[model samples]
Target: MKIIILGAGQVGGTLAENLVGENNDITIVDKDPERLRELQDKYDLRVVNGYASHPRTLEEAGAGDADMLVAVTNSDETNMIACQVAFTLFNTPNRVARIRSPEYLRAKQRLFLSDAVPVDHLIAPEELVTSYIKRLIAYPGALQVVTFAEDKVSLVAVKAYYGGPLVGNALSTLREHMPHIDTRVAAIFRQGQPIRPKGTTVIEADDEVFFVAASGHIRDVMSELQRLEKPYKRIMIVGGGNIGAGLAKQLEIDYSVKLIERNLARAEYLSEKLQNTIVFCGDAADQELLSEENIEQVDVFIAVTNEDESNIMSAMLAKRMGAKKVMVLIQRGAYVDLVQGGNIDIAISPQQATISALLTHVRRGDIVSVSSLRRGAAEAIEAIAHGDSANSKVVGRAIGDIKLPPGTTIGAIVRGESVIIANDRTVIEQNDHVVMFLVDKKYVPDVERLFQPSPFFL
Candidate 1:
């Protein structure tokens, strides 16, 4: 579980802290001695101050023994080159690079099977951020869309709006209406954390919900609830850089897209590459220009400019001006929570999104505790509750009998072919898939034992 991270910038720093805190042996590499020193001071790991793409640098940082090498420097080329060095020179098993360019993204088809660009994963933050906003509009009431444990299971987040379909209905009552669904309400997050939802746990307006189901059930659940029924046609994206271009390409097949950028040269260049998208050359913050372009009638407005404040302000203006959905792409984690909680429908962080995607497959030993904290887009959590095995102390007990943690909500249990949502009297069957909310990684063992009475891991 040794991970070497290149670039101590926003994304790299966030990844290092989160992964290291999760008990992985992490080493951060950067040219900045001060950044490396600062990370070393804060966390318990090795920090190497050198160019990660150099052989001597990898030797100094011990990348030869690293389980994975992460190159996420500000420079996309640097990050890619760093990954190449990690793979070629250090012979690292896994190599991940942070690519912010649209050309590389579009070249993914060519690179997918090519060893020249033999990266395990390439993270495009702008694409991820814009897609989040697209998902919100595509599925109106659903609060989240998360792929869990290898995309076999999808976790959908929904908000119970006033007069919403399931308002004031019992979880069981709601399920009776929709038959043949291979999913469950799992755990409900009301008043916060996981609760033994009773018949009286009425689905109120704005009550955030997480539903775990098979991937195919996504459209079914959203369609039944009158959310995410119809796909979008027109999307207006502000900013013509990597994010806007990436979105334009990703969504062009289904939607008529427009991209606005202040830089005429870039806009003209983007226009040449994109066929379905119209590149507009104007200041995105300009109201007159937006109106001239019919921004109000658009289905989704994505503010993905490099400036954090501009993105937030533009998202607000887009929402106020009558765009159906607004999304802001931000690198800083601080603004994500504030904006999402305040008014922004979707807030996507490049660094966090990349980390969440990476962690979905990177589990060491018996630990299964990587989740999308979502800073606030959709809620996707992964946890292993106690089973009948030696590692799990509790089995065949009702959820009500377990000593649960604060801010944690149990969502679903994997029992054979079925993933069951819990009621107070719902018993924890043996070898169940117990999913919980807000469960911290540090106390995972303690939390695991709480479900089943056990002495300790022997």
Candidate 2:
């Protein structure tokens, strides 16, 4: 695939790195020469240094022969105008833009028409990050939660603790513990190393475990591997930025919500805007402010400030101050593993969330969804099997007979309204959605190839 990306910021840079690995002819356009040079020196891709929305810049980046155009520059106007220019001048088949403002998003239908701005897809990092946090709050104790087949099946990651039922036991004991619930252990991570799960594989303490089960059984399966947290009620957010404000808006009705902003004017604005949330004017890292607000009684403490260092420090302090669970919104990938392994319960990378959402459209075949797991080292993909037995490699074949890559597991299959846990003898059929887990992402291409229909169908 030939791809051109606008902006050298976090989202565009990360997307370029991911797409370059797939053997795509990637070109990134940005205003900063230093950023462009950094990307060009690191990856095997072209970089254009100029105003991203300019026609000359797009032409220099090979927009004429590009298969897709991704405009994710910092400015919403620039991103939208770049898409319109690509559609009108280059006629690029696909155009994806990153839009942040809610006001612009309200006119999505009007702006994205071919006769208008012509954006085929809009990636909202703040919206995606807010929803991701809400999912974690909804399902306590989960490090990450990804749904497949319209929420029929879920893949959840949890850290193993000493008190869990199956923490020190082999994977096979899960059935003995609860024979009624059908679930599959997708992958286990021990000290950052991927472990292919089997009946004999034992889950050790501190290991990150990923499992697939019916959406209703997600909490039940999580309790088997780690002590389940009580449903959160009191939620404290340490920023009034877009992500923090958006999350509070969604969770305030269900839970007692409080938002702390360092700026008094911003706090006043948030107070006026929020109906059920309590807005406070204070530094989130200040111990006196946290203590006065009864931080120890808060069930969940989330730090979503723009500064990574501030968010990390505030979250760690909250955890120490007796907040049940602490989540930090971090931008740098270097800080994700470092913070997640420590006091912070979850360290979310905004770029990773944006990249995963963008990948859903970039993936080939009939793939419906793709989620980056373990900080992009692993992935869970949901793909639909098309064509018949003669035209597809996966359809009408038992899972055991299919040529699946090593370290890849077919966790579940969703047929119409029913969700089925995968087994050795389970046979795939046309139009069935297959949810797969890839522990080793090096084999992602192989797994993708297996789901593609033969040339006869094409």
Candidate 3:
């Protein structure tokens, strides 16, 4: 696909890097020469520097022949204008804009009601990252949230302790303990490639385990496997940035959030901005000071410090001090490898998450909304059904009859308001909103055909 990306900042730069996987003909446009230089140095792509709103600028950037134009500038106004120009002047097939002001996402339904600008998609990275924080709190053990088709199923990650019972046991053994919980252990990665764990494969201690389960039975599976008691009540956050503030505000309702910052001005700012959480001004790295605040009692310790090393060290310290779950946001790629199968529960990057979400929507035009889960190996796809699907060869045919590919399942058939888990007998009715759990990317079109009846097939 011929793609044009406006804004070569942190998010856009990251997008350009990830776009290499698709090997799409990509052109990045921005006003900063240094950032463009960095982008050029890093990725195999063309870079243009100028105002995206300018017609000649976009034309020079080859937006005219572009299949997609993505406006990911810091300013939402810039993104909105760039997308409009791409549509009206360049006639791009797809246009996406990233809006920072979160309220726009909330009022998107009414704001974009007229469709004045043909912005096909809108991304809010902060909102996306905040949702991650929410998911972590909701399920303390799971580092990543991978929701499957119809939101019926989810894949959660949990780190097993050194002397846990599940260790030295095959994941299949989980079924015997929790028979009622209908879940599967999809893939386990301990020493390299993803292993479809069998009855004989012994799970080692300190292994990061990824488990798949029906959404309803998620809790049951977690309780059965982990067995570690007590819900995480008190939490300590070691940053006062937007991510920290957003996470604090979102999680403060259920859990007691104590936000510690070194800057007095920033601390006061947080105190005023956030209502429920207690904002304290002090060096969070100070061991004595942290101890005075009873950091040892903190059930969940989150290190979202601006510096990657600080966050890592803080989280490690929290773990040493007996914090149940520790999560850190490590932005740099090199450092990410350091935490792989390491102590910290999760090491997330805001930039990576944002760029990833944008790229996900860029690839998934047919899927109404898409979230690439399990580190982009699997996709949670929501697509609308057409009449052709109901009259296809697969229709009235049991799933077993058709060569249903591995790791692919019909998550739910959303007829209306209700979410229905699909069974072999369940028919794909026309105009149904079909949600699918797709593992192989090549079979997306085939999966789409399964929902939409094709006249040729019947």
My TM-score estimates for the predictions, one after another, are: 0.78, 0.98, 0.81
**Higher-scoring candidate on TM-score, 2 or 3:** 2
Worst 10 residues of 1 by lDDT: 374-383
Candidates 1 and 3 compared by TM-score, better number: 3
Best by TM-score: 2
lDDT of 2: 0.91
How do the candidates rank by TM-score, highest first?
Answer: 2, 3, 1
Candidate that scores best on lDDT: 2
Instruction: Determine the backbone clash count of candidate 1.
Output: 11
Report the lDDT of model 3 for residue 268: 96
RMSD of 2: 1.4
lDDT scores in order: 0.69, 0.91, 0.72
How well is each residue in 235-279 modelled by candidate 1, as lDDT tens digits? Answer: 888888776777787778778888888898999999999988888
Per residue, candidate 3 scores C-alpha lDDT tens digits across 91-186 of 888888888775677778766432585778877777778787777677756656656454666667676666666777776687687775556564
Off by over 4 Å in 3: 17-24, 31-46, 91-93, 102-118, 148-151, 160-172, 197-207, 340-343, 373-458
